[model samples]
Target chain A: MQINLPSLDGTENITAVCMRPDRYTRLYEALTCDTPVIARGGGLSYCNAGAGRGCRTVVSTCFDRILAFDAEKRLLTVEPGMRLGDLFEFAVRHGLYFPVLPGHPSITVGGCAGFNVHGKTQHNVGHFIDYVERFTLFHPDHGEITCSRTDHESLFRLTIGGFGLTGYITNITLRLIPLKGRSVLFQKRFVANLKEAVEVMKQLSEKVDVLYSWNNLNKTGDAFGEGIVFSEQFIDEETSARDKPFHLFTPDMRSVLRFNFYYRPSAHMECAVYYNMERLTGVEKRCALKATAFPIHGKEIYYLLFGKQGLREYQMLIPHDEWAGALDDLRALMNRMKMPLTLGSMKFFTGAQDLLNYRGDGICLVLDVPANRNSVEYFNKLDEIVIAHKGVVNLSKDSRLTAGTVATMFPEYERFKNELNEFDPKKRFNSALRMRIDV
Target chain B: MSDKKTAVVIGASSGVGRAMARELAYRGYRLVLVARDRAELDILAGDLRIRAKVEAVVSPLDLAAATTSGIQEFVARCAADHPAIERVAITAGQVSDDDQGPTPLPLLESIVKTNYLAVIELVAGFARHMEQHAGGTIAVCSSIAAATPRGRNTVYSSAKAGLETYCRGLQHHYRDTPVRIQAFALGYVDTAMSFGQKLLFPAASAEDTARYMADKMSTDFRVGFYPRFWRPIVMVLAHLPWGVYKRMKF
Candidate 1:
């Protein structure tokens, strides 16, 4: 069967077969087939963690359920098919929460677990595996194996953020945040340029709970990093103390259309950001925590804004020492390629703990470039810049990277393959992204 | 942990019960979270501990099992562990098993046991515990389904109706005592139960519904509507003539 999955960046996901697995037994059975296999979650990953395309792809959405929940212990044992929205709803309702979750609610537990995703508060809270107590895996030959800190420790680290290369993760036991309040205290400060932004981040790194910034992409000449710095703190209060508790999200087509039609970071978009940044400078706002969880607008709208062709998201982590120099190389590459970036976001990472982790004592910069003729080569060059800087490309977000390039970047890539090969030596497990990167 | 004021939140795992528990926790109340899923309950407790910086204990019980005395045992456990209990919020609800044709009697019985009988047992046990403390508050969640019983969700509606009736008696019983009981009549709420479906008019978010219920429960009102908009809607529907109401679709 012909299955097409278009990423948020407009690249079509063309695959020969797609298998929806309801149980771990079924997933194991599917893995035994002759063709290469990969698992697809909620499909929120712009990066190719699913590894679809000409492979026997098993969609994991049907595997959804809350197998066990220990709210006090803050442990969630769930199937990979569960969506972040459901988990967030369940967690917040219980006065608990999940950390380092990507903004889009459609992102699945399996996807986050596989990629070990992080969000705005990552610098403070850490990655997906930070909360993961353990995971239940289905090996092609070994059957079900439980991996955690106490048991199968290396396998546990390998499996987490391993991009499903190790085996199929059927269930995950995660530690969660037991938050008292349903909201966060947010503040936005404007910076003059990248220099000021880095300085401010250094000062606030240990002080604030939430920290990240949006770049002034619309600016020309020297003001590339000049934009808004958004910082937030989780308020400690009873959820009941608020005057208004329920702030529902309703999708409006008008905003979607506007973004789709005229939402590029062009002069008009730049002007909007400029005024918004000017007005929001030094202003602190408090809102229900969910308000901050997703973007102030919504992911759906931002998604729709990409239009039919879609946009490519290239995220890379550059060391703190080379951060400014790397940005110079990046801007030059974008200029040389003539592919102007639509959006850019920067966040601080303390370091990575997972086997194939992106976190490091560095600055992670994510760029949104409209998918076009120049885009692929531009991304490839971006990978080169990261490798040169002794930084790592966010494999979970990069579709253009190759195994050769990733090997040079992530020193642990060879070991990750060795660990994976030990379980499925024939290399039956794969995804389009993993294969593209030659992983 | 024990030094803080304690609140025993029933249905602390999801829906309005989950919301109400979260709201109360923000008010600086130590919590004993009760639900069938101990894992989820503990997750909530963990959240309260981290976010509110308060102690939240988990007490998971099968609300439907009768002979095993799920409610009695759970309350006994609460009294033993959290003796300073001041509030009890029941936000648990149930629906018909929609899997096969013609819902079975056992499933209907389970629905009633969870939605009605288990609730009464919890109130009776907690009411006694609250009798020792002054200004103890007990809040229960009813539904719009109770006002007009329809054929589709007959068991669920009847269970809610029975619960509301019991609350009336509970109010009378606790009239002289400081233990006050509040009933929340809520309309359509956007929750996991209502996931991937379109709901009727006058719907609100779970966070909003939870916050509203938590705040009002602290007041003197015996009964309240979740969004407050639902009160008029339910009132107009209750007064509608059967002939006209029967012709209309829910």
Candidate 2:
């Protein structure tokens, strides 16, 4: 049969399938009939998590619907196809909220859970699975089964980051939190040195509910730590009513930016330097500068400082006790290597409840520099520095961490894999991350 | 007699595919247009024939339905009737938001079959005939968004990416063969499909992109990135260290 699959990004394609299955049972039957079966949801995954290569049968959970919801209790029972955005709206209306959300609003709940997604507030709430109460899944041969923290806890843990390999997630029961108010108390701060920034974040960690920072990639000198620190706390109903709410929205601006974001300077000196470069218009040198400045676009001058060579970041978590030394060591490394520092930022995280949480009990320093692709040697050197400090790299948000380094960083790999094995022996859900981390 | 050559374009009813059909006709390639919308295809065929003085054939049928055993027969019939066909371009596609409800599994399956699997089946059937006749070119349109996995439209990217990869692999397999395979990793194109979308980046006109692709098909490059300049830009973005890339607003 011919099938038409539409992607979330508005692209479409028509393919031929040998068979189709509405449910897991039907899918299993088709699989047994020599038809390759692949599971699909809203088709939100960046990689091929839902579809199979050369697979003839595709089983979709797009038919999923809400099974139950408890507004007072702040719990929701929904099918795999329920959109994360819709759930958020539903929660907000009920004076509750799903604490974690990725950038895209239209992603499916199943996708969020499947990837074991983390959010900006990962330091506090952990991964999406931490809030999941329980779920019912349909397997190829195992049949329908319910997994939770109590019963099949290992399977539950495995499926959390399993990316849908264990089986088809039919219905999920998520634990939602009651919102004090829709308004947020936002604050921004700036730091001087990397050490000072770390110290500030450690001190702020105890006072704030949510914290994250954006480093000025273009800053230099004593104010290298110049960046934006965003902290938010849920406001009381009375306070919310007094202030105007700034609803965040994304607009379409295509023509202005075809392929790259334009870079601007933060200070007069930076603008002078940019202008001076424009004056030295030799073809070869100008091309080199343009390459270095490519990654830093938009209005952020700090980022453009990394130049166009492109930038690479080495971000990791340090235990609260080790944070001070980690900062000192990082500074020492930078001094010893004479590294051209572009930008740096520090964020405080209140340890998450999940075992795979990277934010255990300290702050994370994300070091950004232009990536020198020609020199694989420097990446290894940076990897060594992070590993020697006993820091764990966030694999989901990384592209350079080697498999060996990732294995060392995430010691729970064996445990996560064991859980994966118990759930999906065939290793159905896989991506570049899995291959990189050797998970 | 004019040595203008001839090309067959499937899915020429509307959108980027229709634009591509017109583009090829404008370039003086005798056209063979196939699509599910017969009336629309006829109108397009007539326009191209009148406007460009290009010989046109409007073969309209449901590509999805034809894939079920009938597709092979259909291709054989086309080859027998249109002996002058030298190049075959597949552009058939479909779009749905699942707004009506959850897309039934059957419908999703049909989409995969039409947009992806059927292309391979049709290519295989056409390649064999084209190969026996000595030489021909096959061009499959795909998208650059396939470079990154998205939360929305997961299956659509997968299919396009998969097809692009498959075509690349097939090109390698047919290195010494007379048949040439070209995969177009297109970014957004200005078409009805993108009518209301306020895209983050400027989109190319289908006509401009199609003309570029058609002009470059005879080149040694098997995979062509439309607008050419985006190749290195997207390549760098795709390989960026995730930590930094994730921080920036897309």
Candidate 3:
């Protein structure tokens, strides 16, 4: 049936034919159909990557299930629809941990694999693809094919960050690392500005188990990037700390109402208040492991506050050496633009860059601005600065990036398109992102 | 080694059946997931075992082709294998949109067997076994379409209506016994069955519907409508005059 499919940031909504299949037989039927299809997990992508204008969007939420968990091997076999929060909770019980997890627990593992998501601890373990051992993808023409580093090596690389265009990912086997304990010493360090925040993050990246910084972009001059740099290190031993159960939060109408409460006062005020409150609060506190990994669960209302007009989320990875120059450009653009930056954050990432994968040695900067008439111009300017610095824009997070911008940012864009075309000439699996990028 | 009671959830692969299995598993009941799709059943069973720390047994069976005696034997085997089997829920149902139009005889028989005959057979088997064993609860899903047979869903609604009447009779017969029977006349549930259909009221999610059914399974409730709002609406519709109803389009 045709349903209104919205992006995570509410930037775009497309009325597409959506099918939610809970069983394997139904999923097979959905994949084998003649119509162009795309697999949707959690529908939490900031862009309209999960749905296309005319293609059928196959929602995999109901297909969520863990097929196998071998604690001895520290390997987990799960369906594409399983949420990261549910995976984390299950892993913690067995004294294992999934290192590369996105902030929102509701984000699906399939999404992470598709986007090649980088997390707070990405500097240490790399992208989500680093942990995915293998996956079984079902294409309409190709049927089911197992892709991994050893077998179908090229297909594996292309499909990892192919944005679900390769096929419908049915089964994924993830390799997990061992955890010391379920508790962490969560610390909040105050930074004076973007320069200071970068210095602190670089210094602590080698020491902290998990590291990320939240900047108050609403501020100007010296206070522009001034915010809290949050760090977490696992406790040596298991304490009697009572951790909250793992919950995959699904937003309801109440969340919208709650978001409007904080939203009407303006996001700038909220940012300043949050920054000042964190500065006043104690630096160190014991926190549950899941809390450190998924801080966005309870605060899902924040995403809703953007309202129907939505917000443009531009996440770019800038090299460590070029970050200083990029920061200057960002400040200059911020001063010149009328659009307020609703959110700004940064995380360290280290990985070998490949076909369309959002991975490299850099400080990933994420910015959210309320969508408006000037959104296109503001982001276009931001895009020029990023491309000049040889930075890569995260296609998964930003919806407004032009096809020209993406081609300019990622050198392997053409190769990805070629490989995808060679694999499936018809491109049976498709989405809005694919159509937008003209890939 | 574990002393947990087992719950059999028929048609546990999809829709409300799938949700019902998850709910029962969460409630600390060892599950017997019965469905025709073995792959789907295995996936669900594995998930329940991991998430809920409960044992789940996958029992693959084609309810449309299942015989009454065959179903009785299966129930007896389940009771014998797990003496702790204290609850049974039948959430299996089938419907074809072609039912409103001219449907083939084979399709009609399949629907009857799946929606009515198979459900009644399983209910009878479970109720009798539970009566002899420890007094267990048996709940089956009916439909709000059964309130009054309309031209929209002729055979499907008729089958559900028959199943509902049979369950009511079973409840009356088991009133003095240890067996407790609950029949849920569900409304438009957000399952594959109602995925694309435009309807007046928003379809209730299968998860929420299953949770309600699971909550009432152990209680003394005999018969009720899911999403309770459907109860009054169906009641009014059932009481409507034949002339007025015939002219209405829903």
Candidate 3 on A30-67: residue-level lDDT in tens? 77877789988877888888899989999888867888
**Of models 2 and 3, which has the larger lDDT?**
3
Query: Residue B166: error of model 2 in Å?
Result: 44
* Model 2 CAPRI rating: incorrect
Q: Global lDDT of each model? A: 0.73, 0.60, 0.84
User: How would you encode candidate 1's per-residue C-alpha lDDT over A260-303 as one tens digit per residue?
Assistant: 34343353464465548557554786677776776633535454
- lDDT by residue (B69-147, candidate 2, tens digit) is 7788878877777665678888776555551234467677776777788888777777777777766888888777567
Model 3 chain A scores worst on lDDT over the 10 consecutive residues at: A251-260
Q: lDDT for model 2, on a 0 to 1 scale?
A: 0.60
lDDT of 2 at B109: 73
Best by TM-score: 3
DockQ of each: 0.04, 0.02, 0.59
Q: Which stretches of candidate 3 lie over 4 Å from their true place?
A: A236-265, A276-282, B1-4, B26-28, B46-55, B101-109, B146-151, B154-158, B197-212, B225-250
> Mind giving the per-residue lDDT tens digits that candidate 2 earns over A44-90?
44234454444543434332345666656777887675566557656
TM-score for candidate 2, residues paired by index: 0.50
